[model samples]
Target: MTETDTLRERVAVELTRARERTLTLADAVDDHDLVRQHSPLMSPLVWDVAHVGNQEELWLVRDVGRREPVRADIDTMYDAFQHPRADRPALPLLDPTEARAYIRTVRDKALDVLGAEPLAGRRLTTDGFVFGLIVQHEQQHDETMLATHQLRTGPAVLDAPPPPAPDVPVDDRAEVVVPAGAFTMGTSVEPWALDNERPGHTVDLPAYAIDAVPVTNRRYAEFVADGGYDEPRWWTADGWAHRREAGLTMPMHWHGDGTATRFGRRTDLPPDEPVLHVCWYEAAAFAAWAGRRLPTEAEWEKAARWDPATGRSRRYPWGDDDPTARHANLGQRHLRPARVGAYPLGVSPLGVHQLVGDVWEWTATEFTGYPGFTVFPYREYSEVFFDRGYRVLRGGSFGTDPVACRGTFRNWDWPVRRQIFAGFRTARDVA
Candidate 1:
């Protein structure tokens, strides 16, 4: 009824949604495949699923004194922060059925307890905060899983790769014009934004135009067809070296008879599907080939945040509502990149399609701190990858949790390694 009640209800709903997502993701992967070491960045799928459940229980129940049910060995098996991956493979893992059941039990217990009492006035302890962090953390891993699977299995799961755009379209044709103004950027106000998005600050921008849609598979195909991969002129030194080392000739989930195909499915190229599995180098090369460049992080936020009438920050591209299937491709059963132009309503203020959820858009800026940036108590958040080699990525992907797709959310990865749900869109400085 009241605002406090509404907030509490939202939190409860979020917890339910989080549980549902974890269960669905866990169920999607074959039990036998859960143990495979997909990549160094990825944990075994089983471990991640149990870890998510354990984290929720540890946070809301054990730490909060409701002290509801949890697996006895959870501390030993799923305590990821304390025990890293090197230690995971050797642990006595629960059987897939048991693990799923345990996860459901913990989730139900957490919901029953939290639902009874509103989370409104509850003061979260450090451990409790860690639980919240794990939720987002696990959601990120889920996205990675989808990406890794696509990379390994090809576009059999994707709807299909779209045909390349016709001549990159006119540069200004579908641009969402953002007016000049100052707006807050970052996570200062939100209680749960990642450290990188935190200490929100105001940013000033001159007028700018951003693409109304993410770069399509067809558009990127054009780049590759134009020798973007072979052209040293299109690549940075680091990018070229990465290309040479990885032997990357196309986007990660592409294959066909000398043409690009989406992962996991045989279908006609859709031309409207957003590109997926592109590394920073590929994204950059495609941009260069098209005579445009990836949007800077600030430019992206500006275009997504600008308000036409009042010029205020829009909480999300589609407004403050949480993501839904109608809004974006996230939380779907297929867990693959969707057609690019599918969610017209999800466009950012500046007309950037799929700004919130589809595939993360690679930005030109290096991952770095804003003014007054400080690390969280744990060192692994932002400080782990401040090196110049990493690039910033924005917008959450189809595999991403809705909560993790907040406009200010910041994700980073090495420019060369495109393993985890990485993709890009292009932008150019308006004349």
Candidate 2:
């Protein structure tokens, strides 16, 4: 039909899919399971689910001209910041059925209004921002819920393997060599990227040879076999200390038998599959053992996206369509890491495999602000992580929201913490 009709249809589909995702998540756990908190900081599943629904109402109905769907008490039940995790036990409980109903009602109202309106050119302002944020927020909850279930429930149900990678023809050695040049990094136009990727700036990168594909399990296995973990020479002093403290011998999900198994599902570590679950130290050691280094954040960004005109500043590696399954492993049905090299089209201009998904690739640059960098109006996102030590990780993982998987999206984890879905690729400065 018309463009407006098309937009409405897409919105309807998104709402329906979100509702289905919520239902699936709710059904996966029992009421008893919902009450239990997996971590001291994380909210209980029931509260989290309700919070997702409540967010929809707050943004769409209250903020977007639609009528409020519930009593004001609903706010008190789901304000996460107001009702901290510590206070969850003391807060009034919401029956699971009632909470689900409220969520469904909010979704239904949003669908109705969106379908009726002609919103093609209408610039989304505050309420629209909330709508997008809530959708992504729910997706994040979906991932966290799965992680919580894994932690709380025994591995029996939680340990199913991620689905097989979609059969895309892969040429294992198809490499893209990037000639070095100066480029502007980060997002110029702010749509929905987090504060960390904001206030795009320029960066110069030297000519470097980066692997066409992420380091594979087979490749990393060679390093491990050669005593990469035991040798301190390969690791930075800080990395060495972190490794010693954690007592890590190999990648987190890798088994003694040498197969890459995640959540208890065994898959052949295809030589072509990008190596995953590696922390920064492990990545550095692997690079050292292999005579290479991890790409600097600027170098990685340049290879991913190269702007031709100014010879500076690139937006996305694959030129910015947002990430799709055809492009990357993000937003897959399986809630775990994927085999690297699965998505060829998603490769950066430099031909790196799985740059936007499968796993987050750790970069060499420490987390710091660009020149003239200022905190966003919202403080908690990036400002808290600006200490001297933390390193940047580019490319979102399979567990990340597809909408959130922009080339500019910047994530950082402590070099020592390997529990999260993090991995790395290598880059060597040209000789």
Best by lDDT: 1
lDDT of each: 0.69, 0.69
lDDT of each residue in 168-226, candidate 2, tens digit only: 65553344567756677887575655567777886766678777766776778888889
On residues 216-275, what C-alpha lDDT tens digit does candidate 1 reach at each position? 766777777777788998988888988998899887656644344334554454555677
What's the TM-score of every candidate structure?
0.82, 0.80
Error of 1 at 72 (Å): 7.4
Where model 2 places Cα greater than 4 Å from the true spot, the runs are 1-12, 37-44, 57-99, 105-127, 149-177, 264-268, 307-315, 334-340, 372-377
lDDT of 2: 0.69
Residues forming the 10-long window of minimal summed lDDT in candidate 2: 120-129
Work out candidate 2's RMSD over C-alphas.
Answer: 4.2
